[model samples]
Target: MELFVFVCAAIMVLVGALGVVLRSNPVHAALSMILTLFGVAVLFVAREANFLAAVQVIVYAGAIVVLFLFVIMLLGVDRAEDLRTEPLGNVQRPLALVLGIGMFALLTTAVVRSRDSLRFKGDGVKTATLEDADGNIRQIARSIFGDYVVAFELTSVLLIVAVVGTVVLARRRKSERTAS
Candidate 1:
């Protein structure tokens, strides 16, 4: 049952990734990214990483995707306009297909090779217990506050900048429309 769920989640994640890459419209791509994040969260839950899964859903699928959608809506860019200026040409399609296939083959080979050499004593989920949870959480908190403090701070700053930028852009658009 778990294996089946994992397979389904993996398939969903792959399809979502492809959708994100292949969708011409930015909004559709952002929605696909949200789908991908949700699939990943499902996988995390299946693996018994409940806390991480919750965080993934809340932070990524909820906050980040909403932010992405807000930015896309605020930009007021038409999907038709973007499609007209697509970077890829018909001549490159075959080459791109071949390259993608080759990359997939390489990745499959790597996974097959890595799986053989891996050794496990017990089920990983069983080992990820509540007794260890407190220590792990403490370590993570310390690392986030210490080694990754600058990155954490920078992320907050970036988010603030994005919010301000979105407000300014929307206001400018509103003013322009009024003037027109």
Candidate 2:
């Protein structure tokens, strides 16, 4: 049953990824990304990372995808276009292909050569005990608030700044249109 769920989620992820890459429509691509995010959430659940699964669904699939669609609709990029035309000229396609293949080769070489370095070298991860109902949550909270508090706070501030900036830009544009 576990294997079946994993396989199904993996397939969903792969198909969604392909849809994201291959779809010409921005809305369709964003929807595909949602599918990918949901599949990732399922995989996180399979790994017993319930918090991460919830974050994946709520933060990525919900908030981030909504932001993407909002931006797409705001910028009016939902129209069909000629996919064959190269906006960056003929050189970019070949250059991109070469760079992609080189990157793949480098990644493959690193993974093959660094097999031993991937093992966990630190002490065992601290997990919640069976008796403590909120052990996992407590440990996660401590790790996030105690160890990575600054990073977490900074991320929140940055997101807030981004939202404010977007709103300001949109208001400015609207005022300009009214003035015009």
TM-score of every model versus the real structure: 0.66, 0.80
Model 1 Cα lDDT, one tens digit per residue, 3-25:
89889899889889998888878
Model 1: weakest 10-residue lDDT segment is: 120-129
- Spell out the clash pairs found in candidate 2: none
After superposition, which runs of candidate 1 have C-alpha atoms over 4 Å from their true positions? Answer: 78-87, 120-180
**Winner by TM-score:** 2
Q: Model 2 compared with the native: what TM-score?
A: 0.80
lDDT of 2 by residue, 1-180 (tens): 999999999998989988897788889999999889989999987886777788889999878999999989999999755567638688987898899889989999999999988887764444445777565677788889998999989999998999899797766666788999
Question: Which residue runs of candidate 2 sit more than 4 Å off their true CA positions?
Answer: 1-3, 86-88, 123-133, 173-175, 178-180
RMSD for all candidates, in order, please.
5.0, 2.9
Q: Give the Cα error of residue 82 in candidate 1, in Å.
A: 7.7
Which pairs, if any, clash in model 1? none
